[model samples]
Target chain A: MSRWGRRPQLSFPDVGSIEGPLLEVVDLHTSFRTGRGLVRAVDGVSFNLARGHTLGVVGESGSGKTVLSRSIMGLVPGTNVERSGTVRLSGHDITAMSLDELREVWGMQIALVFQDPMTALNPVVRIGRQITESLRLRAGLDRKAAYETSVALLKSVGIPAPEQRLRNYPHELSGGMRQRVMIAIALACGPKLLLADEPTTGLDVTVQAQILDLLAAQQRERHMGMILVTHDLGVVANRTDDIVVMYAGRVVEQAPTAELFARTRMPYTEALLRSIPRLAEASHTRLRAIPGRPPDLATELKGCRFAPRCPYAQDHCRKEEPPLRAAGQGHLFRCWYPVGSAEGDAALAYNVAARVPAALAFTGIPVRDAALVAPNAVGSA
Target chain B: MLRFIATRLVQLVVICFLISVFAFLLVHLLPGDPTLAILGPNDTPAARAVLLHQLGLNKGLVSQYGTWIMNIFHGNLGASFLTKQTVTNALGVAVPIDLELVVVSQVLALLVAIPMALIAALRPNRLFDRIATTSTFAMLSLPTFVAGPLLVLVFAVTLKWVPATGFDRLSQGLGQNLKSVILPSVALAIGSVTVYYRLLRADLIATLQEDFVTMARSKGLSTRYILMRHVMRPSSFSLLAGAGISIGTLFTGAFVVEVLFQLPGIGYQLVQAIYSRDYLVVQGMALVAAVAFVVVNFGVDFLLTILDPRVRRA
Candidate 1:
């Protein structure tokens, strides 16, 4: 191995020594003006990520999770795309930075791992060249130094016989191995932040665990802040320090991971949790699928965008938008009637009694009892 | 790679045999008797029979084919019916002119088309792309007959850049030969450039949309690096495939170009031979053309495999 962690001739932003959180995104909006209309892909998404902390942005398809990560890095491309926000990296405003300035930030200060490894790595280029490109060009390393650093990067990402692998093209490697190569390329510059947008997607179950574990190990070793963007809540449940649940281009709920899970207020968040398959359940148990598609982002939307699919959606939820309100310190959610809350249980009971399809679907759980337990826990604490 | 080459060689042989059979059949397929074409309307019953006997046409069809094939294998292309000149000698004069024209035109086409497509692809539908796209389409509609004369009128007649019409051998002087061939090469090359540019531009636009290109951009690679390193080769697949069939223009003599420019390439000879019913010359030229077409396509396939490793499985 060619000396891991030795970034000779390369500059790195000192982690944890910064005055503020590693990244601060305030009222970030990324929208595309398509033929249909203006599509607000990421609408007013805001969050702060501390150095060495892992924040999970959880959502289903088209939930704007991916766009949020890209917006923060200033990586969103397209002439028609418009981004309005304040994204500060290490106290410097990233969103206001020009493209030439952003180029220096990308891969050196903030790098991204794309979703599909099959298509992420350039198929024709050798694994070595793809990894060493940033080193030679951006880091000002010579050919031999870049070559050695590339092999070391491949080794750090856990590729075996990285020297031999350096000569192999992407097609020669398996999907898992290609992702590792992608990780190596992203990590080649040793950026302070790693935004992995669905990193383990499209891999086997066994390989998924390994890839996620490798990401965690690398994140901890480098003390880099990471934004794990995935649709699967279970993927981030134990791995992340904080979680943001997005719906229709907006974050509906967010909290520290354990606190969010224990006192999950949003019905959408509760529904997401129930949707994950549990091993304790009997084989062939029917999966709890979230009902209805997400609202069309092109059309102007008011109120809670998740109202139509939410089990405890009330009339007020249909009429007016719910502002982000805190359930506890650092725990924010948007809902008129939250899950495990007194109003949430009443709305659920009323809906089930009135034969509302969404609420009746989840009547298998004792909604009232859960709400009762939550209030007592809140009072005691 | 060796296996790919081996398979292509097998294919080339099979293709050549098919061409040979077609060439042999052409005399019978088109209403023609080599001796009748040669003797004119003079009283020639005995002479015709003597010529037929010498030609081995007195034998049955299968035997005639076998004899013809064997004669060709021995490097004997019989004398032209019209001129009484050996078919091999006529081809010896014509082939070099055609080879030069085809090679120069195709090289010129690729040299211009590659960069044109690349720049156009960078900003698709923008001013540069639209202008290039429109100009190529306009050129694509102009056949070689029209384009060849138009070029001569502009560059040769009006501008007095070079001789309007002539054929000079390279041994005379490379400069005179190039000057003689310039108009025809541009005329022939315009069509190829249009085709290659359109194909490569479309493919490059599509390739730029691929996920890997975005990944490259995310790596802080410059636009040029992402385009050249990640985009160009994958985008060239269709252009390479188009070049395979277009190579036919190389040997099919580009009749309009040769005749218009007064270059005695194989195409001009083939047309002249057809008019005079010089069946032996036609047969020889046809066989050479078919072989050239197949060989060029095999080379295209070989180049494609080198560009894209995914094709190595074939």
Candidate 2:
């Protein structure tokens, strides 16, 4: 044991998955029973992350990224939550563990760094007291030892005058320092899996870059699996090894960092990439804006969740919900007819043909010849 | 902190001045005249008018108020109309007895209330919590007057263990006086403790949900240690606020308890003064009560700032 006390060392289960990834989530479906009905926040979402790898979960607001992280930590509040599916960490099934069992694994096997460090830390308490509270409880450390360890934790996160800063309240620290303190707190027990929920959302762009670099360095040093949830594609594009694109509570696409950018099958993933303004590109061209808002969760969707927004959606896409089929060796997409390249006559024809059959099946809107119609209004004409 | 104190002091002065004016007007506007009440019904009209003038009733309302406030701003609190002695001197002797009673009652109430709250929180849906809830509800419904006689019947009339009425000061070698104060303090505290337990238990339960407490549990701290070191300290902030409000309202409740126990407090003196229609004494006692309220509120505010850093920063 360490100097503080005898803390049980967490054992990684041998599930004969050395050839595979360290963590695997299989068909995870989490729902909350509201007054209206079961709000399926996450439906059949799956991904895996190996040791020393960064998995970026990119989605719009209310797309279930935060809930997914909280589920992994077993920290979902409210009585209406109903979780299902297997979440295997080091080959152990963590989905069925009780809260007491989860407590033993928390901070030592898995830790969470939440968004908004200011709200996460208590305002009425000193930094030292808040940090040492866990140590004193779990490690059987007395006050003096806990205080010393707290100062050490502060220094590890690169805060200057760590000893004095421990005595200061959270309000006394800046946004960046507070986030660093959060990271320090998460890393206190040296966990293997670190789930960070938009860890640098409210900070300046420069500070955001610095914090991401810090987390990257820590993950590499500890050989830990990190899941970074963010909306900024630029932030994760260069940092993450793999990317899982979520749309309307389902995994729409999954690919390696380079492959996902080079070859995206799902129209939503392509739209997200196209929406980002490239400073290196020609300045005269306008930034592409994704048409329509996200799907309302209160409504029950019948087909593919992104079919209403996808430019290349076909009749089958509207009649049947598309599952994640293999687009390549590692790339996956939920669209029946996936589109990868930029806009062309063939791409336009493909989009028009896809919508015409679906519209015919639903509203009986006859398909018009593109050659006879007006050039500006292809779908309407 | 200094600015807060300065503002409170200004407020205290303004409140005391307004109270004096209201008390003076109330006494003067009543049907009975203080001179006749003190002099009896057979007194001559000429004698009453002469006495009224000497007491400064011939002056305008504004002039009388200004003089009363001026006397109060100095060391003087005016003279009692019936006793014809300095009000400060009379209060100097009576105030300590009231203080003794209030302190003892509040201490006893807190002692019982804290344990009840702890038991209630610890056993939440179990028998202990149910019993505490039932007993507190029963105590809350019972008024001090009813409880006083019931205690008298059980302890004094039936058991014959102690005297049922009156009080003796601590100066009498601390035996009979201390013993005499116990029954009254217990009777007063029973009602107050019921209210206190309800507040404290709610606070304790609320504190149990905080993130720091969750972190403490993850650290593998014992449940008792977490409750004592983390949960209790933060929860006390709310309890301190409730305690402050209770002390502020204590004087209002003190009137009923004092009358039941036959204690010589300012509340009793005010009641006797009102019955006799001694206008000057009533006005003097009202001003003192107003000042006491402002001082007590100010003290509670400071205590809150000391106990809670959020309040201090705010």
Give each model's whole-structure lDDT.
0.85, 0.75
**In every candidate, how many clashes are there?**
0, 5
lDDT of 2 by residue, A1-381 (tens): 434334444455533445667678988888899888888888888888997799999987888888877776666655688888888888778788765566667776777887788766766678887777666655457889988888888887788999888888888899999999888888876778898899999798889988999899889888889999987777889999999988877889899999988887777787787778888989876556665677876678888887766666655666788778886778887776666444323443655554533222222244344334433323311
Q: Give model 2's docking category.
A: acceptable
Model 2 agreement with the true structure over B80-180: per-residue lDDT tens digits: 77787887876776677667777888899999999889878866758999889998999999988888888888887799777777777778758878777
Weakest 10 consecutive residues of candidate 1 chain A by summed lDDT: A372-381
Residue-by-residue lDDT tens digits, candidate 1, B94-175: 8898888888998999999999999998888899999999999899999988888888999998999898998889998999
lDDT, residue B186, candidate 2: 79
**DockQ of every model listed?**
0.50, 0.30
Specify the poorest-scoring 10-residue window by lDDT in model 2 chain B.
B213-222
Q: Candidate 1 — which pairs collide?
A: none
What is the TM-score of candidate 2? 0.79
- Top candidate when judged by TM-score against the true structure: 1
